[model samples]
Every structure is written in C-alpha cells, then in structure tokens.
Target: MQGILVSILVGLCTGVGALPFLFIKKVPQALKDGLLGFASGIMVFASSFNLIQPALKDGNLLSVIGGIIIGTMILTFIEHLIPHTHTKNYDENDDSSVLKKNILLAIAVAIHNVPEGFAIGVGYGTGNVSTGLSLALAIGVQNIPEGLVVAAPLIEGGYPRGKALLFSFLTGIGEPIAAAIGFFAARLTDKLLPFILSIAAGAMFYVVSHELIPESHCNNNEMLATYGFIIGLILMIIFRTVIGE
Candidate 1:
C-alpha cells in the first residue's frame, strides 16, 4: 500500500511540473520541437537498451517482440480512432480550433503516460526500486513537452493563463491511475509481471517513434533534435548502469 502511494505521488509530480507554464504568454516552436525530439530519442533508447535487452537476457525474446508489436498496434488503433491535431502558431488565416487541439493533445499524452506509470509501479512492486525510479523520472522529464503541448493550445484558445496551465497539469493525472492499477495487479499475480512491464516498454517505444519523433521534426531542426535524443539515451544508459537499475 505504501508503495502504491509513493508511486502515485511520484506520478502526480509529473503534473505539478507543468505549473510554470501558467505564466508564459508565448512558447517558442523551436524549443518545443527540440525538447520533444530529445524525449523521443530517450524513449527509443530506453526501450531498446533497457527494456528489450533485459527481456532478451531473460530468454523471453518472443514475448518481447510480441509485446512490442502489440503496443505499436494499440497506438495505431488509437490514432485511427481519434485524429490528433497540432497546435500551430497563430496566423491571420489559420482556422485551427485551439480547444479541440489541446484536448486531443491531452488524450495523446495521457495514453503515453499510462504505460509509463505502469512500468514504474510494477518495478517498485517487484522490488526493482532503481528501475522504477529511473523509469518514472525519465518519463516525467519527457512529459514536460506534453504539458507544453496542452498549454500551447489552451493559451492560444484565449483562456486565462491559470486555466490553461491547470488544464495542462490535469492531463497528466493518468500516470498515477496507471501506477495504482499496475501495483495492485502485480500484488494479485506475480506471473503477470513480465508481460505488463514488457507491454509498457513496447507502448513507450511506439509513442516515441510514432508521435514524439514526428512532433520534434515539426517544431525544431532535425539535426538538433536528433542530437538531443542521443543525449537523452546516453543519459538513460548512464543512469541505469551507474544506479544498477
């Protein structure tokens, strides 16, 4: 129970991290794209290096691959269900509905966060504190852009700064809900653990490749975004190795 609470608090911190956006009048497009790209790189590297390789070491390559495919398919299915919209810069001729765009962005970010929190909760429940913390912090860091993604549209939509920021912050609450579910499920059945963790790894990989990478390209220099991504991966490796997660 304590572990679950801790996980929820950790997840909630991701939402709190968005508080700063309430004061920003305008955010730079290039900055958003660059950060998003960097995050994508981190997610990809983490999935491959940390998640997939570890599963392979456990002699579960088939499950790992299946998990990846399943995760990717889930995202693809969701994308088909609801078309995502980007928050474009305000222009005289633009017809974008800011509210609709932000809402969609929130949903997309929430989808990604659910798997992340699950990974964290499962890690902690199974006595893998280092792994859980690393995953949570990494996922949280990556979520900053998600907050911005939500905030930009709300701000553009003419909402008060506070309301926009509040909306952005609220979108990330799914992480804790995921954590609670994962932790409780693991407590109920240990055999299901590997599948859940692998599924999360797969989902995160899908999100990075399908969503974050493309968003990065849209808002920043591709080369710089790529550089940031590499840095994110390296940092993840360093943390994992040094912390022995």
Candidate 2:
C-alpha cells in the first residue's frame, strides 16, 4: 500500500510539471524541439538502463530478449491500428496542428505511463523503500520535462491554458492504475515480472525512436534537437547509474 501511494505520487508529477503552462501562451520552437529531444533521451536511457538491465538480472536472458521483441512489436501494431494524426500531417501554420499533436502525444504518453507506474510499484513491492523511491524519483524527474513537452504545443495551437494542462493531467492518471496492478502482480507471480519489465523497455524504445525523436527533428532546428537529445541522454545515464544501480 505504501509503495502504491509512492508510485501514484510519482505519477502526479506529470500534472505538477504541467502547471507552468497554465499561464504561458506560446513556446519557442528551439525550446520545444529541445524538450522533445530531452524526453526521447530520458525514455531511451530509462528503458535500457533501468528496465532492461534489471530484467536481465532477475530472469533468464532468453525470456527477457523475447519480451523485448514482443513489446516493440506490440507498440508497432498499436501505432498502425490507431492511425493517429499529427502536426506534420497538417500545416504547422494551421491552427489545428497543435491540438492534433497534443492529442496524439497524450494518447501515447498515457499508454506508456501505465507500464512506468507499474515498474515503480513493483520496485517497492519486490524490494525495499530505497528501491521503490529510487524508481519513483527517476520517473518523477522525467515527468517534469515531459509536462513541458505535452503542454507547449497545445498552448500555442489555441488551446486555453487550462484545457491543455487538463489533457496532460488526465494522461497522468494511467500511472496509479498501473502501479496498483504492478504491486499485486509482482506479489502473485515471480516468473511473469521479468518479462513484463522487458516488454516495457521495448515499448519505450519504440516510442523514442518512432515518436519523440521524429517530432523533434521535424522542424528546422535539428541541431538544437540533437544537442537536447545528447544532454538528456547523459543526464538519464548518470541518473540511472546512481539510482538504478
């Protein structure tokens, strides 16, 4: 129960980070690209260092490898089934582009957050306070920048500040639900947990490559995007090295 609460708290950071966009009307293009790149970096590093590594330690290497393949394929299938629209499909100058991007981004983030929330709960359930809180803190740190990534476009695209933030908040709710589920699942079956963790890693890797990175580079600010990705990657690597170890 305590671990579940902590996981929910970590999930709530999504809303807290998004609170800033409530007053802002526009975001700079360079900043937007940077934020996207940063998010991509975080997801990539977190998936590789935190999720996959831990799975390898806990389970057979073959099962973990299979989970990774299956996870990536699952997300890929979802991508095609959804057929979501995005800013690139419409003119950036168009008024509706921002809303479109936000819609798709929110959906993707929400789906991913469930696994992340579960991971946090499982960390605590399977180990101790230190394990749980460390996972929570890492997700919480990433959520701060993610809030910026989700809200910036909506504000510029004519969404009222409140509405944009509301969308972000709603997506964050996935964490608590998954966290509770994870806590229970880990306790019920030891064999399943490792594969689930690896699946999460693969799903996140797909998102970073297919979604966030592409979105960042879509604009002319490729250089800023690259710089942001590198910085974010370094930060997450260091963060994982310290906390996830």
Give residue 26's lDDT in candidate 2 (0 to 100).
70
Residue-wise lDDT of candidate 2 within 1-245, one digit each (tens)?
88778777777777776787756667687887887787677667767766777788889899899988987898888888765654467766655665566677878777767767877777766665665676677677767667776777777666788887887777778888878876787777778878877876777677778777777887787888888888878886676567646
Where does candidate 1 stray beyond 4 Å?
13-17, 86-92, 188-191
Query: After superposition on all CA atoms, what RMSD does each candidate show versus the true structure?
Result: 2.7, 2.4
Name the 10 consecutive residues with the lowest summed lDDT in model 1.
86-95
Residue-level lDDT tens digits of model 1 in 94-171: 445545556677788877777777766766666666666776667767777667766775676677878776776666
Alpha carbon RMSD to native, model 2:
2.4
Q: Provide the global lDDT of candidate 2 against the true structure.
A: 0.74
Per-model TM-score on C-alpha atoms: 0.86, 0.86
Indicate the TM-score of model 2. 0.86
Clashes of 2: 0
Highest TM-score model number: 2
